[model samples]
Target: MSVDIHFNASALGSIQEVSLVLFKSWSEKKTLPMKLTKQGWKVSLSLPAGEYKYAFIVNGGIRLNDPEANAYAPDDDEKIWSVLLINAKGQRLHSNQSYRVHLHDYSLATRFDGPGLPGVHKQINLAIDESIVSRFEFTQVEGLHTVTLAWYTPDARLLQWSDHYLVENETSAPIELMFRCQPKTLMQSPLLGIWSLKMFIDGAFVLEDDFKVVDEEVYSRRDFLGCGAD
Candidate 1:
């Protein structure tokens, strides 16, 4: 079977060579033969459907993470991504298909907003879901601060759905308004899976937008302003 792995490195940097290895189990022979390309990489091998462990050997000796994997590991403060190989016939080979993986630096910076701030220094506790699927941080400039949260899909598709909370003295505070700019794919799900915002001021609801559900990916800016004060 031929498995094609495609990736863009113009965002990360020109890569010299890439290496990959597949392990049949925790204590099995290691399969380390894959090819690289200008766009990504591909491999041709004949193996039965089963759970496998893999890793990326970047350049020559640098071990890196897989950008396409579905799961990730937090080891020594490092992230790793992996994928599950299944029979083309759609039969379950392994009970656990969820693999931990990490995003390439290029993909992370280009596809998502960064420094997680609007201006100068600020104290923020950036939290992400266990899947590392989303991130939250706070930015401050001259004592004026705002919280910014971001989410993304495995394919580097930005998830438009998100929420930010304003707190004062360790308690939720009222927000004046909230705004978000996201891609149209969020409208694909009947539930408007893209980014969303919820605002509250003085312990009361100020504004909320669930977003319009649609069939296509629509990139647009949504604003919620002039909410009431309680």
Candidate 2:
């Protein structure tokens, strides 16, 4: 069987150190093929049909959650990572197929291709349950930028509502709405903010926007309550 693992560091310029452990029964042992790269890491291993446990060691200890891992083991302290066991016929041999859960029907909306500047604008419309839930005014800079929108549930857990925006060329370029994330609870009051903006064009850094996040009180008192609440 072939196994692949991938992951990325949480912060820019941070080096990710990693290790892989393979276990079969309590005694069976083998070596596996592994490789690491700038984007993440990958490993390929061949094994007999059976159950096994693998661990990823990173930063001097075991790591959790391969961002690119498609399998997971439920652990309270860590997000699960994906794993797969395949048969000689190239079919996945790990069963319990009836209980598998899948996520669908999630979406994000934003615009690309805007004038490149600090206040260049675009709008984002979000709808849920057939109702218009929220709208966003995205301001673009000359390079890469991140916007963080967050809210709190009635239960008081802070939830993130966010996306990334990239401006590829200095002139008129095709921009992307790129990534969008939706929090699981609608009961949470939605809060939004532009967390950071780092811009680069023609392979050189041009500008950076790392503003002090406005105090939570400002968002709490505002008339807009995020994407889901009136």
Candidate 3:
């Protein structure tokens, strides 16, 4: 029996075109196109258990591998290909089940198109139960830029704290690292409300953004923050 696989190429966001290629088993060697969905660019395939080499063709020319690839190997032409190991006994949805399946465990990668400058933006986590996401996307000059985040409850209690580092080469346009403050995990329940967020860049306070969580799609906020968040 073969296993159904779902590959996500949403890291590049919505661009010109995103395609997939399979290698290793000569019979399954082919290129497949991905569709842009609400969650992101996704494509499903059926295959038996085996270690296959694959790569993504972006815009019909660029041969890019998955950003979240587990391993990578060089092809005969020295071109690199991402590796994926499929387990025959892996967990899967029922044949009649109408649900989504992630490549591995549920990856928490969110798609954020940073067409604008450096700042935090609000997004919804469609992969989950449509939760809240405070996505932070930005670009900067050389040197190690450390992003420190702290989430506080409405009562001013510390909810979550996280930090990430990014080192860029000496260039004008560098890849901007994407980070987010979800305030909770898929396993744990979320506390819906406007949560305060304090961000620090390289040890200094940079900015403060709030995440207004709700169960609906409409965007809104109160005129005044009842808590003293200064």
Candidate 4:
């Protein structure tokens, strides 16, 4: 059966392309090219019913696991790979199903295009439902819960961070939170890389997701002029 696989790494800028390294038949390794899309990367392939593991290679290097991968297991060397099961259509298998948290809606915006640069404007909008308030340990007080936004480099290093946001429990209704997070200094400009927004409730990690600052799209004027070598 042919199954469609998708991987979005919009947060990782400067990436020209991504390829899928599929581990099939218990030991066979197959590499397939994935197409780039405005949203991210995707590929479709038909394979015999069985289990498989795969990893994404950025450009020609940098192996990474699919952030939205259904399942994952570590190898003897401690390398992690995404897992897949081709049993039925529309059926999914996840290892972290119980701990999965959902946001009502979320969106990210940035001013710089193509790849991230220093001091680029960035923002995030998050909506939460009253039903999930207990997940953040609503203490009936607005000042108890805290929200943290951290930016990391491509190699996964802390680059920039914002102060904690205190949650306000004024009503038991749904609420939306907006954060304007862009660095103001050259040191902060080093924030040009893939990072994750982490939500904390009383020092506990409640929500987290990764994002990229650059992609394969050519945005420079020189590239438009056919004068720049990409």
Candidate 5:
């Protein structure tokens, strides 16, 4: 269904453009330009029945998580943002786990979406949840090695991977790469199936995760047919 999302930035009278960057799960990222209204800077979108996280991009430079948003999540860098739940039924999606580090007194953990939409860009993402916020610090450190993110199909067919290599030590540094690909390139792959993501450190394997690529099933299902029980 469609919802009217409002943001109050009238205090910044000189501000001109305000864009809404909505991310359903971590995969689907849409940038909608908001119009200044008497109520506030607002925009309407027809989102499926599910949870979403959104932030207001002011002047295409500053990214402000909704201060008014009650539900929230943190990025890889521990920056908390506003999150919204559409048709939630107390169903938790991902499993959380913790790991101990040997040298840096650091522990690593990761969370990901259970399933995603058709577009590849919106299909898979790497994120850290709230449980490990206090323990993991993503501060940059030297002696980091090369990092790469790769995507693969369920049957182990490689679809597309990140060409840009990040030179940082995975063990000493923090994992902050959000793997995204071109919409057209991802669309060429199977629309409905399982996909996987593999992280490589200096050409050696690190960790792997998987997510489902469901079509309209995400919307057709009962969980998404309506908002939470009322």
Candidate 6:
């Protein structure tokens, strides 16, 4: 099913051009030039059911994110854009651990001791994140499960980690996998902005999430934040 997606541009007035860039498309044609309308700058795309990484190319040089997009993701150049999650029936999804195939529960947070350990997924501390984990629990599925976690830096570098598990619906129980990141290298001052994580089960797209990389203290007065979930 193909859904009609309407992208209302941010009020970046008096710009020369506004083009919509959709990454991870099924076809080679990804970028779509938007048109101005009475409702301001807008673009409409007939997209299939899947997750799309997108951003707005304003004036052909400046890359801007759809402020009102479902979510935001950073590209290879550390340029922050937007994310569009489409379900099978052409509905927009927020990735709040909704009805996903073969997935039971998914949670993301930073390892900072506070009133709420690893507070929210919005802002992450760069200094004191000695232990950060991405946990996922899968429903009972028989056979060998190979899960791969791909991490992307703000500037679009890669750090990948994988885990293998055996499970049976009748005989074996399941344990949530903790994909830990190199805190000293990952959460630091130099690497600050948006970082993304992709989970692939048996070479199939299972789920994806993004987080902002910031420089702040575990219990400090101010907050140095990155990009994602905003």
Quick one: best lDDT, which candidate? Answer: 6
Q: Deviation in angstroms for 145 in model 4?
A: 25
Q: If the candidates were sorted by their TM-score against the true structure, best first, what order would they fall in? A: 6, 4, 5, 3, 1, 2
Where does the lowest 10-residue lDDT sum fall in candidate 4? 126-135
CA-lDDT, candidates in order? 0.37, 0.36, 0.52, 0.52, 0.50, 0.59
Clash count in backbone of candidate 5: 5
Residue 190 Cα positional deviation in candidate 1, in Å, after optimal superposition: 54
Q: Which pairs clash in model 6?
A: 212-227
Better of 3 and 6 by lDDT: 6
Please identify which of the two predictions, 4 or 6, would achieve the higher lDDT against the true structure: 6
Pairs that collide, model 5: 27-122, 144-168, 144-169, 145-168, 145-169
Q: Put down candidate 4 lDDT per residue, 1-230, tens digits, no spaces.
A: 77778776544446777899998644688999999776668898877777788877766754556545665565566455667877655444555552222344444554223332223223221221111111122233332223444455556654544323334445764444545444334243334455566553322345566665542233677667896656
Residue range 1-230, candidate 2, lDDT tens digits: 55455544433233345566565543653334346765666676655665554555444432333333323343243323234455657544544432211111122223323433233222222332212122233333342232223322223333333323333355443343333334324425343333333222211233332222122332344456464674
Which ranges in model 2 have alpha carbons more than 4 Å from their true place? 29-34, 74-82, 88-230
Candidate 1: Cα lDDT at 42: 60
Question: Each model's TM-score, in the order given?
Answer: 0.35, 0.32, 0.36, 0.42, 0.37, 0.45
Residue 80, candidate 2: alpha-carbon lDDT:
32
Model 1: lDDT to the true structure: 0.37
Model 5, position 10: C-alpha lDDT score? 39
Q: Pick the candidate with the highest TM-score.
A: 6
lDDT string, candidate 3, 90-185, tens digits: 533222322111111111223334454423334334334343334454444343344555566555555666555545556545444444555455
The local lDDT score (0 to 100) that residue 41 gets in candidate 5 is 84
Per-model C-alpha RMSD: 18.7, 15.4, 17.5, 16.8, 21.7, 14.5
